[model samples]
Target chain A: SAVISQKPSRDICQRGTSLTIQCQVDSQVTMMFWYRQQPGQSLTLIATANQGSEATYESGFVIDKFPISRPNLTFSTLTVSNMSPEDSSIYLCSVGTGGPNYGYTFGSGTRLTVV
Target chain B: AQSVTQPDIHITVSEGASLELRCNYSYGATPYLFWYVQSPGQGLQLLLKYFSGDTLVQGIKGFEAEFKRSQSSFNLRKPSVHWSDAAEYFCAVGAAKLIFGTGTRLQVFP
Candidate 1:
């Protein structure tokens, strides 16, 4: 098991502003992912951040909307650019090791409310 | 395309009662299945997962699930419910890129 933490556990921002959420893991992990949970909806994968490489985004998600940065094995940041009320929701970061079947550990999540 | 489905939107259960949450998936191949719990104002925590062999998998916090390949289902169950168990539960499939279901919100009453 690993202890994961996110900064700005909860935040409220004005529309058109951008916020960068930070994810730090207690130990080094190979795979770090960013997810978005819309109000009353399921979570959607935003992208996968790997050290020394650009993030891999899902079909509906793009780097321009959600820019990601992975500077090391244990840390990653996701910047929600051009925020809107629709972007108000919980953002989660999960860390996992690659394999056929493996477990995932997630940060407590950042609750963002864009007004 | 890979997708996960959690049919139930909200489930209310009395405390100390048994509980079961339904989930189903559609994928091209044998898929990895997982159950995760998210308390209000908290990130999601892994409840259990099934990747292969064992059809039944045990998870922390007294949660268990069984995988049915024929039905494309992985359902979560608990013998007795606790008020603390009131939270949102999500079912996910796929290993590299997890596709999560809409989620089931569990409500517990005294």
Candidate 2:
């Protein structure tokens, strides 16, 4: 299993502003996933990042709205652009441990509040 | 399309009482099930997962889940509920990309 260090555990930003959340993994991984958990809602996949490649966004999400950067195997960043009150949610990063069972490790998550 | 369903939105139980949280998932291929607990202001922690072999799997915090393929269900169970066990539990199904259930919020009363 890998441990992830996420920055800005939480933040409050005004509408129309952008916030970038970062996740650093202790071990190298091939793919990292970004998820959004809205208040009182289940988690939804935002995008999947692979090193040196553009992220693959989910159907409802877009690259412009939620840009992702996977600079290397151990680090990734997700930026929420043009924030709105609706953008307020908890963002999480996860990496899968390749094996027979394929276990996944998740970051602490960033709680963002757009005013 | 893959999906998960957690019927219970909230569940309240007394300390030391047995607890069960229901979960159901729909997927075309062999399903990989997982249970995760999320505490307030904390990260999601894996409680248990079922990939193959035995149907019943034990997890941390004395939690266990039984995967029933015929029923398309993976329900979480605990012999005795603890106050610290109060949290939101999510059931997911998938390998690389997961589809999560709505989640069940447990409230333990001492």
Candidate 3:
């Protein structure tokens, strides 16, 4: 099992401002993913970050809006740019470990509120 | 593409009563199934997973899930419910990339 620590547990930002959330894992992992949980909605995958490679984003998400950085196996960051009220949501960092059946270990999550 | 479906959007159960949350999936082959629990303002915690072999798999917090291939379902069960168990539960399927269900919110009443 891996322990993921995410910073800025909760933050309030002004519209047009940007916020970057950091995730640090205790153990090195091959796959790190970013997810967003909007108000009263299910979690949606924002992007997949592999160390030393460009992040792969899912449909409807662009690198310009959500830039991801995976510096190494144990560290990654997700930045929400030009935040708006719609960006108010919980951003989660997760690491994929174990085998094919193995599930992911997630960070506590960052709650962002845009005013 | 892999997708998960949770039929019940919200469930209310009495404390100490048995509970069951249903999950169904759509995938080409036998996919990895998982159940996760999320408390208010907290991250998701894995309850159980079913990859292969035994149909029933046990997990932490006294939770268990059964993978029924015929029905394409993996339902989470608990013999008894606790007040602290009131939270949102999600079902996910995949290997490297996971597709999560809409989630079911459980409300335990004393």
Candidate 4:
């Protein structure tokens, strides 16, 4: 399993501002996933970040709104653009440990509050 | 499409009591099932997961889950509930990308 260090553990920003959340994995991985967990809601996949390629966003999410960067196998960043109160949520980064029955490792998460 | 369902939105149990949290999932093939616990103001922790072989899998913190193929279910259980066990539980199904259930919040009373 890999350990992820996600920073800005939390932040408060004004509406229309943007925040970039970073995740650094101790070990290299092929794909990293970004998720949004709204208050009192289940986690939703925002996008899949693959090294050396443009991130693949989920249907309801877009690159402009939630741009992702996977500069390498061990690091990725997700930026929430043009923030609104509705954008307030916990953002998490995850990586799958490759094996027959491997599980995914998640970052501590970033709690963002848009005022 | 893969989807997970946790019918119970909230559950309350007395400390030291046995606990069970129901989870159901829909997927086309043999699904990768997982149970994760999220404490207040903390990250999501993987409790248990079922890939294959054993129908009943043990996880950290005395948590276990049984995967029933026919029922399309993967329910989490614990022999005794502790105060620290109170948290939000999510059931997810998938391999690369996970589809999570709405989640069940557990409340333990002494």
Model 1 quality (TM-score):
0.94
On DockQ, the candidate that comes out on top is 4
lDDT of 3 by residue, A5-113 (tens): 9998999999999999999999889989999999877889999998999999999999999999999999999999999999999999999998654679889999999
Ranking by lDDT: 4, 2, 3, 1
Ranking by TM-score: 4, 2, 3, 1
Q: Where does candidate 4 stray beyond 4 Å?
A: none
**Superposed Cα deviation of residue A64, candidate 2 (Å):** 0.8
* Model 4: per-residue Cα lDDT over B1-110, one tens digit each: 67899999999999999999999999998899999999999999999999999899999999999999999999999999999999999999998789999999999999
lDDT of 4 at B32: 93
Q: Candidate 2 residues B48-102, lDDT tens each? A: 9999999999999999999999999999999999999999999999987888999
Worst 10 residues of 3 chain B by lDDT: B27-36
- Name the docking class for model 3: high
lDDT of each: 0.90, 0.94, 0.93, 0.94
Model 1 chain A worst lDDT window (10 residues): A96-105
| Global Cα lDDT for candidate 4 | 0.94
For each candidate in turn, the TM-score is 0.94, 0.98, 0.97, 0.98
Superposed by TM-score, candidate 3 places the C-alpha of residue A6 at a distance from the truth, in angstroms, of 0.4
